[model samples]
Target: MIFIEHILERPNKKPILIDLRHNESETQPIVIFCHGYKGYKDWGAWNLMADAIANAGFCVIKFNFSHNGGTMENPIDFPDLEAFGNNNYTKELEDLHGVVDWVQNEFKHDNHIDVSQISTIGHSRGGGIVLLHASEDSRIKRVITLASVCNFGKRSSTIGDLERWQKDGVKYVRNGRTNQDMPHYFQFYEDFKANEERLHIESAVKRLTIPTLIIHGNKDTSISMDEALNLYEWKPDSKLVIIENADHVFNTKQPWESDDLSPELKTVCEEITHFLKQSEV
Candidate 1:
């Protein structure tokens, strides 16, 4: 299998990482994964999942968003919140389009890999992104979302909170895991507000003609199961799979414990494989 780390060009000083996993000799399908807000390319068991998908006869490309708070040197956590604050939904969608163009035209993959067959997968906010992008981009043949938000226009209604964020220029949200202050400058709200129409999840999902898979955990608190149901409701042709006992992350962590995939995640992966295969026919 071919393993490569490439620096993708972006307006930001720090270029995003384009991590590729695939066998050069085999002709396989392409799968691009997008990480959620505050998430990186190498977060949790994503690398392992990439390898697993590659081994299952697909070329998997995963990348960190340009302003996902992970710098090129340390592409993991919130080292630069200023970039994060400036990130807008349109920027990320464009970044994903860039990656797709690179993979399909610029980069050479295994002989078995089929560049014409491309699928996109995203988690949390990233999930919403792929959903919206697939609707707009005709090159995307399939889309999958994990714990995706159903709407991009939802914002906190507290006038006082908005006033404080605007007054302070930046607001900090606690990272329960790392215990660091996650900064959200007033620009984040501005970016979201400006691109609300383009980022509308329901509108995108409603227009999607390609096959889609919506995966969510029953106990997910960050993005509730209702969001997944909403996605299904918007796109009735899309398949919905709910993991009964799993949480948001599907029982995996940064320093992932087992070399083998978790049962919940394995199920999700299998479902994706089945969907992709069925689509091929």
Candidate 2:
């Protein structure tokens, strides 16, 4: 498989780290995978997932959102908390747009990717980000969301917490895995409020005419199954698959030790490959 890591940079925006994986095929459908909040391109078994999709005969492009906290030097941990704090929905949308634009116009030639046939797969919060992008961007032909959240307005903080955030101008969420206090500036909420209509997941999903696959674990504790049901209800034509006994990460963990995917994640990847292949026809 051909593996290349490049940085997608712009004048003012922070540089986004991107990874492209595929065989020597001259032309193949493209799959752009988006990692969830606090997630990076190399998180857990995602590289393995990308390789699996590539081996299945597609070019898999996985990228880190510019403001995802990991700097160019270290793309895995929370080394740049300021950037993480400044990240908002708008920035993430722009980052996704940037990746798509690069894939369609710039990277296709070098990577032998089919710019015309593009699919996006997002996990958790990235799921919602892809949904909004797919609704607005006609270039995305298919979308697969794994353990995605249905609503962005839902507060991770309480009223008292919001009050404190308002007074302090920022709030922090502790990362249990890294033991870092990730910051969420008040502007993050402000930006979401400013673009509430554009960021509505229900409206976006309703507007999406392309094939969409919603996959969620039945035992997911982070995002409830109702969100998946809500997505299915919003897009009646979209397919929903609930894996029984799987967790939010689909049984995959950080510092993944095994060479092969966990049974649940392997199943998820199989479903994804099947869906993309079927969509091609």
Candidate 3:
């Protein structure tokens, strides 16, 4: 297996910390995973989930975005809140591209993966990112979103909050799990405003030509089923999977201790693997 974890550095930019998992003996399809807001590569059961996918015969690459609060040295949790606060949609998009560029060259000599068969899976905020990128990047053959948000602009905007955010220059959202009041500088919204067209998930969804898989938990309180329905509606050909009674993270939690994945997450992995196999056929 080509199991490796390293930080991909960029000139005058935050580095992306990535984890690669797959068998190096055979050529495989590529699957890149993008984590959601306040999420890291090793968050919760993501590593196990990635391993499961990699074992199912695909090269899985998961990365923490350059400004996702984590660092090259400490990638698990919020060690660099300042970076997190400074993060923006355009920056995340650039980070995803950087990861893709790295993967294409990392094992070129061994021919470990067919770069042409690249696909991506994103969760929540990352889902939107993947959609936006796939709309523009022809290299991505398939796209999957887990409990994703359908609209970035709506999620970030509220007339009352906007005025307060503008006046205060920042906003704080408490991370229920970490108990930290994460700061969001007004630039987050400003960035969204500046790149409104490029960052619109709805527009991206409408423009995509490749296959899409929208997965959601019926009981997800963070991002409702309506969002998944919206994606399905926009692209009727897209496959939609609804996990009964599963929460936002599909019943998985941070600091997940068990060696085994949650029953719901296991089912999710099976669905993902199945989708990938059939899509290839």
RMSD after CA superposition, every candidate: 1.9, 1.2, 1.1
Residue 264 CA displacement from its true place in model 1, Å:
0.7
TM-score of each: 0.93, 0.97, 0.97
Candidate 2 lDDT over residue span 156-218, tens digit each:
446657777889999888999999989999988888889999989999999999999999999
Each prediction's number of clashing residue pairs: 7, 0, 0
Model 2 TM-score, all chains together: 0.97
Per-residue lDDT tens digits of candidate 3, residues 32-52?
999999998889999899999
Worst 10 residues of 1 by lDDT: 151-160
Model 1 residue 156 CA deviation (Å) reads 6.8
Model 3: how far is 59 from its true place, Å?
0.3
Pairs in steric clash, model 1: 24-110, 26-112, 27-111, 27-112, 27-113, 28-112, 28-113
By lDDT, the better pick of 1 and 3 is: 3
Winner on lDDT (1 vs 2): 2
lDDT of 2 at 158: 61
Give the Å shift of residue 113 in candidate 2. Answer: 1.7
Local distance difference test values of all predictions, in order:
0.84, 0.92, 0.91
